[model samples]
Target: MEAVILAGIARRVLDELLRNPYRTIELRSARNVMAVEAALREAMRLFLTYDPFEDVSTGTEGLLAELMEAKYLETRIPWEESDEREVTICRAKVKLVGLGRVVEVERRKGVMLARVRELFPHEMDIG
Candidate 1:
């Protein structure tokens, strides 16, 4: 299911960001930031491509929603470029429409700031 894949990707991104040496940095030039964006885009591509028959567990939707709320991953309409939209990941469902177009999955900025504040409050003054 897309939600499972997305949750996995979000967890990986968070782990990578936390492990990176420049986790405290705010600049986009940081390798971790670029990698996070690239990973998100790739996950979008995967979402657009894959159609599996496995059923998702009831708990996955909650997990995905939590990740989205935490700003780990986001879904949006590509052309409108508006704020994040609500996306429901259906299990074993085929995407009949919009197969030719791309879905936008973005890495949100709040994750880093919130993570830093939670994990390294004393280091906040150093940045």
Candidate 2:
């Protein structure tokens, strides 16, 4: 369940990051496990806003399962801050299913999200 929540947070952060490239965000800046949980709640709220009849009681767990089943995430790696450091400050990468786009992030003690940012062209190994 923790993995599900983290993945959803990563997706949301990735979506936001892609829209505004080069902006860095502290993943847990809202500052706690509840912050990630709140993001999930907000997502459910938005879904309900459009489809009022839809059931959102299951919250993010079902969504996470679907994402995993659909292979929405191509890769999710957690490592020490020393492993990779750019001006962006991310220490991990989460590559989504299509388009090969990737989101880099930093996680502290393997539990809390530290920071995140979109990868630049050169950072992505592109010419």
Candidate 3:
């Protein structure tokens, strides 16, 4: 479930990164895992605006599955940042499935959201 929650957080930042194209370096600012989790929770609550208590698939991974199937996310990576230097990124890229096309996120949010667009382009919109 952590995946779902993380995905949501990454998505939120992705939206922002895509909007300006200059925020690509913001992903390196995540200080810890807890911060990532918090960002994910915020994304789920604010953007999704769904109650976890009411939904059975409220787990982090569960949420990610829904978003992927719905064509929301394109890629995700599990990494840790401590030096504030953009040279330590080493997480593998995970593809987030859309409704019709397959989009791979080259760099995920918080730690790598600035490159989401270069990583994934809008090829198909199933919804």
Winner of 1 and 2 under lDDT = 2
Give the runs in model 1 whose Cα sits over 4 Å from its true position: 1-29, 44-127
* Prediction 3 TM-score vs. true: 0.20
| lDDT (tens digit, per residue) of candidate 3 on 1-127 | 1222232235454444335432322222223233344434444211121222222231211112122111112233436644332332212222233211112222245431211111124442211
Least accurate 10 contiguous residues by lDDT in model 3 = 62-71
Model 1's TM-score against the true structure: 0.16
For each candidate, the alpha-carbon lDDT, in order, equals 0.25, 0.27, 0.27
Where is the poorest 10-residue window by lDDT in model 1? 110-119
Q: At residue 42, give the lDDT of candidate 1.
A: 38
Better of 1 and 3 by TM-score: 3
Q: Give the per-residue lDDT of model 1 (tens digit) for 1-72.
A: 221122222333333333441222121222333433443443421221121113222211211111211123
Clashes of each: 0, 0, 11
List TM-scores for all candidates, in order. Answer: 0.16, 0.20, 0.20
Task: For residue 69, give model 3's deviation from the true position in Å.
Answer: 30
Candidate 2 residue 115 Cα shift, in angstroms, is 25
